[model samples]
Target chain A: AQTVTQSQPEMSVQEAETVTLSCTYDTSESDYYLFWYKQPPSRQMILVIRQEAYKQQNATENRFSVNFQKAAKSFSLKISDSQLGDAAMYFCAYRRGGGGSNYKLTFGKGTLLTVNP
Target chain B: DTAVSQTPKYLVTQMGNDKSIKCEQNLGHDTMYWYKQDSKKFLKIMFSYNNKELIINETVPNRFSPKSPDKAHLNLHINSLELGDSAVYFCASSQGDRVRGTQYFGPGTRLLVL
Candidate 1:
């Protein structure tokens, strides 16, 4: 079984600043997918960014980027130019590369991010 | 248009009561899934359906039942709900391709069992 861990229970970042949320996972699969999801107070989960294990280059989406280290089993999310809208509960998820049950996502407990103005 | 939707955004029921949460997807995806977010905010997969067929059934309790009447709708019926059953239930959909497709999730229904 694969388990994702978010060591930081809470994180705070000032507006227009940058912050990073740490994430680590335990999985034996060579090829997999890592994802960061944001859940606002509205309870809607939104995809922030995704990284493929095979890709050496980190994935960047707008102000959201990921530092994916396959060897260390670490996948951290970096929020740049953070805004008030970035305040939410961020989750790190892992998914196997293939179809069927392998596609099921294993999510981390979540890190509550607070953006201060 | 909403890609995925779930009814009763908030549900409050007494223990031992039976309740059903309905889910529908407007996207033409072939796979749908039900996920549970516990109090600690740990999200886990409970059930998954593909094209009206049951695919992945996690180690969920028998009190929880998932029914897919069609490819676009998957409803969850919980019988004799308990206090431990209180959690936010999310419905999601994705393409059934060999490659892992991105899943679109619903807003989620918060169930509170008293």
Candidate 2:
């Protein structure tokens, strides 16, 4: 079974600063996907960004980017120019690339992110 | 328009009671899933259906039942609920069970079993 680990339980950053949430996974399969989901106090799960294991180029979405190191089995999320709305519980999730049971998403325990003004 | 939606945003019921939460997706996706977020903020997959067919059934208790009347709708029915079942349930959908397909999540239903 694949497992995702978010070492940081809580992270805080000042407004307009940058912060990175650490995440690592143990997966034997070379083909897989990693994702970052944000859950605000509203309890809504919003997709921050995603990275395909085969793609060496990191994924970027506006102020959100991911440093995906397949060899090290590490995928960390970087939030730049952080805003108050960015405060939320961030989760790192993993899924198999294909084949049976690939539909499942294994999520980490989540890291609470606080943005201070 | 909301891509995915779940009804009864908040549910409070006594133990041993039965409750049902409905989930619908307007994204025209072929796959839908049910995930449980426990008190510790840990998320896990409970069930998944693709094209109205049960695909993935995690090691969830038998008291929990999932019904998919069609591809666009999946409803969860919990019988004899227990306090341990109190948590947030999220419904999500993707274009297919493919690797790159991004799953879009719903607002989530917060269930509290007293």
Candidate 3:
């Protein structure tokens, strides 16, 4: 079974600054996918960024990026130019890349981020 | 338009009661899923349906049942609910393919069992 761990339960960042959220996972599969999802107070889960385990280069989307280290089994999310809207609970999820159980997602406990003005 | 939607945004019921939550997707995707977020914020998959067929069924209790009348809809029915079952249920959809497809989630339905 694959397990995702988010060590930090709470994090805070000043407005217009950068913040990094750490995540680590244990998986025996060589092919897999890592994702970061954001949930605001409104309770909507939104995808922030995704990284493929095979890709050496990190994934970047707008102000959100991921530092994917396959060897270390670490995938961290970085938010640049953080704004008040970035304040939310972030979840790190892992999914199998192939086979029958690919539809399932394993999620972490989550990290609550507070963006201060 | 909302890609995915779940009915009854909030549900409150007494113990041993029966209830159902409906989920529908307008994204035209072939796969739909049900996930439960516990009080401690741990999210886990309960069931998955692909093209109206049961694909993945986790180690959930028999009191919880999932029905998929069509590819675009998946409904969860709970019988004899317990306080331990109180959690947020999320509905999601994605394209059924060999590779990992991005999933679109619906605003969760908060269930409270008193």
The candidates' DockQ values read 0.66, 0.70, 0.71
Q: What is the lDDT of candidate 3?
A: 0.93
- lDDT at position B114, candidate 3: 97
lDDT of 3 by residue, A18-71 (tens): 999999999999988899999999989999998888889999999999999899
Per-candidate Cα lDDT values, in order, are 0.93, 0.93, 0.93
Mind giving the per-residue lDDT tens digits that candidate 1 earns over B27-111? 9989899999999899999999988988889999999999999989999999999999999999999887746567889999999
Which rank order by DockQ, best down to worst? 3, 2, 1
Model 2: runs farther than 4 Å from truth? none
lDDT of 3 by residue, B4-90 (tens): 999999999999999999999998999999999998888899999998888888989999999999999999999999999999999
lDDT, candidate 2, A7-106, per-residue tens: 9999999999999999999989988899999999999999999898889999999999999988899999999999999999999999888765446789
lDDT of 1 by residue, A29-117 (tens): 88788899999999999999888898999999999889888899999999999999999999999888864643778899999999999
TM-score of model 2 (CA atoms):
0.98
Error of 3 at A44 (Å): 0.7
